[model samples]
Target: MEKIFTLFLFLPIFALAQKESIWDLEELYKTPKYEETDLVNKKGVKSIFYESIDYKGKPTKVYAYYNIPTTERPENGYPAIVLVHGGGGTAFEDWVKIWNKRGYVAISMDLEGHLPSKNHQDRKNFEGSGPSRHGVFHDNNEALQDQWYYQAVAQVILAHSFLRGLPEVDTNNIGITGVSWGGMLTSSIAGIDDRFKFAIPIYGCGFLNGTDGLMGQHFKNGNQAYRDNLLTNFEAEAFLPKATMPILFINGSNDAHFPIPAMMSSAKAPKSKTYLYVEDGLGHGHPPAWDVEESYRFANAIIHNLPLMDIQKTTWDHSKMDFSAVVKGVRPRKVTAYYTFDKGKWQKRRWNSTPGNIKGTKVNAPIPEEATAAYLIIRDVKGMSLTTEVIFDTSDKQTMK
Candidate 1:
């Protein structure tokens, strides 16, 4: 292989020409600058204030809810996870509590420079709306440091560092997950920050403007110059290739906020090992679409070195779809194939499924003539299930399934 090299200004020797990084993470962490204050302890967790810098070099403080297990933990410490909420979401205490119940130390922080307080539901929440200044998107021509993404991604990494520093957290077992816009940030963070061993990004992947989804349309609303600037710099595609950890892309098959094709693009663009958890007719938001069982299952596999049931390969022809997977750890009672002819506007689509022919861990199914997309589902005897991303027959020129 040929080695590529580059020359830096004022340096005589040529250095390896590595992929250009959108984020100067080293510079962001250079000062170790942040302030922490303890807040009220509630629901088996301790909330606190995690202060850091914004894009404008101003001192900014965001709220976080963190908790250590009350019960006995492993000798080293408990596995920890940092949760970044989507747009309009604050530092939800409930998110922390959910993980605490799962025997993991957890932290949730507000990225919008909001104080984690109480929400309309009266749960401990962040006080601000959206992000600090220009919300999620800002001027593309501005210096990257002064953009919303720079601060948001930095804040997430800083939170990871903060959680790792806690005595009760097992740094080696740390992971990160997020929803919606937070999911997008999670993808970028996974690419830039190699400290996280695993990441789960729900309903948010990058390369938005490339898809025909709402976000792409949203980008089109901006001037072409700004759109081009964003596509070149802040989009997840630019950073995901650098991801060194395992990532699971979980989302609805028909998400209104993020299109399936766009999600696929982000998942495929990354160089890291990727997993999928796409559901039929799954819509946006956390409740019905967020599969906590699968997320924890994947996390446990990573943290404990347990056997994992995962898709090794999937291929589709015009009439048949085939699946190959490693199921060494699980004894599935049933394997099913799901398919849908409905395309576009995932929220309004309906999906149907049928029993798949499972020869050990290999699954084969007949694709309906009208089917546009299909996915495989393996259900263990214990009722736990794992899924694959929507598979399409790219060989066919027609768009309709």
Candidate 2:
């Protein structure tokens, strides 16, 4: 009886230890000690190595490229952003320069522990680097602290902490954007780190196990223990609900990796304001992903307290085959509905667009009878676009709503 009582008393302590072992937020929140380096010699950008969570009981360092705009700093310090690169990408000087030109202090970090190079495969690992990414959940069996996902997330949070300490950064206005795998990280981080003013994840979302993409296949085929650990401790779905900041999800309708359903699931997971910008025929890559104007506008709006284009709700009339949504915020120059009749894989489907009839704040378009899936796109005066969630017709009849 005494042993049983003692076991119950220690259960809470064991649970607490397991929680902390996933990520010690208190430690990661502190400004990480960093060292600046001259390895990158861009005109305005500088490279640095910052301390990260230890891997396998050894210290690790994260490489990053950072810069601030040449313009005079605002009295409250410049709005800042942290750029996370996708698969096979490193901290890019051009990426830092892009945001620097936009009048913000920016930092782009290499989560793979490699120095910046033109070729991803040739990028050399620096001393004291953490474990490199092998696959999404390939290293699940390893110690929690030593896993790639944990290390990557810790490095990103550490970057935010390091950036927040900068004298020229507006700590309250800092935002984060990540492409591809980086987008996946951004999604998860959005929930784990609430200090961010906003988060933009391009071509990334949670609910990986349900999609038809390779990542989803991996999750489906993975062992039960591996799947459990990833879903509970690492995936974005687990963290997005805790996010308090607004999130902008960007993706292509035919993205081979993150499909529309998974993206929608991610957008809905966050309790905070969520916006979608899934474009038809939009290709996936680091350069193309960052080229979206809506991402920049979204960040700018949030930082400057400007209003963003909001779609209140989407409605459909089965008899007329008409789709409509009430639009608010910034008035759009044009609105269009893109639909696809192809049924099997989202990646192989051909999309067709029809102009919407805009009447006041509401826009309406007719979806063809053969269309299996359709979504609305609203383009602003600046040519930037935001989209409503996709509605599907599962049967031969029009069941869109």
Candidate 3:
């Protein structure tokens, strides 16, 4: 074995050696139009001001706001999640009050041409169902490859990572959640990065088809389907399925951009560890659903290591869940879990004391062991409990994974 140091020595940019960042916070943040941007620091929620950062070869600005939590959290690392808005959605993208009030820091950025902050829906009922209906995209293709869109993505991700990097965020439990376009970014990034421990993509996911809204349209420039082949030709499906983190998929039955079958099949998450919502009615809009509320609930469930959430009207009943166990705890480190219901040929789960993963919320392996049966299990892991069982087809249920 040999040790190597001073990486990227052969790279052109590395030769010049000047640190480069992908955020620009000076355009609107420093102006009066953004003057009313609400922010909360030592003070309660106020307005966003301005920030200057280097973006590629030019001076860039980010209109930003800060909202400190109300909880008696320590200053050394409070858990936080990033809130990204959909297309045509800007900074101060409403419903932020809900997050700010819950003792969590929430910041929103404008993802369109760094466009003005007008025409924002905020916390109000959403009327747009897709990007076309969202009413903005004048600079659509202007900032594509590592320019506007990716820059904004990096900025938002950097902002969340910044929170973790801050003296006020818990890096161990940092999470990311977004809606519509935000959801697509969330899924895309969820696959791209390993920093997040939990993720929620509401009205998001399903990029298999090219017509997906938000940023996908930007690449189209009126020729979307062609780019769709470009994407498929490049075979980008390898992205999301590579993610092993616990990701929740919050969606409606009628979402114009995402359909149930496509979303379910396109998602690569293992069944046991995934969260889902398949409700009827309610297309792609945020109202009637407030997706923020879903984000909050899922965030709390994972960040605080609390019980399963109750926000979903649909049923992922425990009767259809099965399990197996692996003994991985190293003696002194241990946990004791009990099953409340049993099903299939196997009435038990792969219950283990493998306390290696943070929160231990990720479960792999199939549920049932053989053909047909029914039972349920209330797994009480260190006082945290959740139920899931199997109703039929128990064959090869335990994967020993």
Candidate 4:
């Protein structure tokens, strides 16, 4: 009788707890009742709620924050850029904003166990830190078998897959960037995944752990027992061949995690295909002064099809733009300006443009108010183009909600 009474007493409490459970992401993501203001586009930032995706038949929810260039209507389909963060860090929303400032779509994917969804309600943020690397490499331990190496690899691939699936996102201009542990995954993704058009990995090195004893536990992108060899197994020199797109490898001269010479050998690409930035006294931080700015500029160039050294103009009010034509054969020293909406009436706006400009890479500029759309008119400048494109964005998106 006492046992029966105790059971009855505990049952309702258990039932009540289940009813009020806060850990259910399904309820959170499915509910469109959330305050849309929380996801509103700010001047340089914004957040979004993405529905769950099927990863290898398992239902998983993903939440990402992003920033996109100012647009009246989400473009037909914008390009994409994917950001992967280092270990122990949750989804990096900042990278999304970084590309947004450059007029690209940025998508940041958070794997499980890091950042809790506002609804996650439980604290497991850093629980999988060790297994994240070990499970993929020495993942034979049965107790932690599900924490397999491929799990992380799958997480990244799925992130790419998610980007590829968005209708408003151009599937052709996919790019990937990662830091530290993320850099390791970036290499693995570039090696196996062919969909990427460009790659930038900061502070990532290959084959060091496979041969070196100190960093061995972390060199996993696969299980050694799963028939395929380990990714950290090959030196950075060997892995260079797998990267087909242009790559900018940024690293601090003082980075403790990856040795410079070994990393350089492994990261080798054709002379035309790579840019290596070495900053003295800077450690493994991604935003280090010397390289971070350069990397962002590089990303801008790679994404926009705009040359890095030119003046860029953004239009206000989404007006149809028309700027003055060149002075015929004067080698484009000064560019004139004119604008009108709806063909109202063409009026010349007083603007000064500098000239000589290093093969017309730069023209002297004079400011013109009411400039409808901005234009760069370069004369007789031979320049190799870097195809810059925005590769990811969730804000103002027309893709699946």
Candidate number achieving the greatest lDDT relative to the actual structure = 2
Among all candidates shown, the one with the greatest TM-score: 2
- Model 3 TM-score, 2 decimals: 0.55
- How would you encode candidate 1's per-residue C-alpha lDDT over 244-324 as one tens digit per residue? 888888887667777666666667666777877776666576555345577887888789887666565565554233433
Candidate 1 residue spans exceeding 4 A from truth: 1-24, 27-43, 117-142, 289-291, 317-331, 380-384, 393-401
When superposed on Cα atoms, how far off is each prediction in RMSD?
8.0, 9.0, 13.4, 23.1
**Model 4 TM-score on a 0 to 1 scale:** 0.53
CA lDDT scores, all candidates in order: 0.68, 0.82, 0.45, 0.44
What value does the lDDT take at residue 342 in candidate 3?
25
Query: What's the CA error at residue 174 for candidate 2, in Å?
Result: 0.4
- Cα TM-score per model: 0.83, 0.92, 0.55, 0.53
The all-Cα superposition gives candidate 3 an RMSD in Å to the true structure of 13.4
Q: What lDDT tens digits, residue by residue, belong to model 3 across residues 1-401?
A: 22111101110100111132223323212222224433323244444433323344453445445566777885555676777677566555354566667666666554442432455543222111111222322323443322344455555655564455456667787777777767767776665556777877777664433333333344456665534432432112334655667777776534655543234433433222665554434456545446435456667777777666221111112334323232222111222222212221121222222121112433323322222322122233333222222222223222100
Work out candidate 2's RMSD over C-alphas: 9.0
lDDT of 1: 0.68
- Cα shift from native, residue 37, model 4 (Å): 13
- Worst 10-residue lDDT window for candidate 3 reads 6-15
The C-alpha local distance difference test score for the whole of candidate 2 amounts to 0.82
C-alpha lDDT of residue 265 in model 1: 63
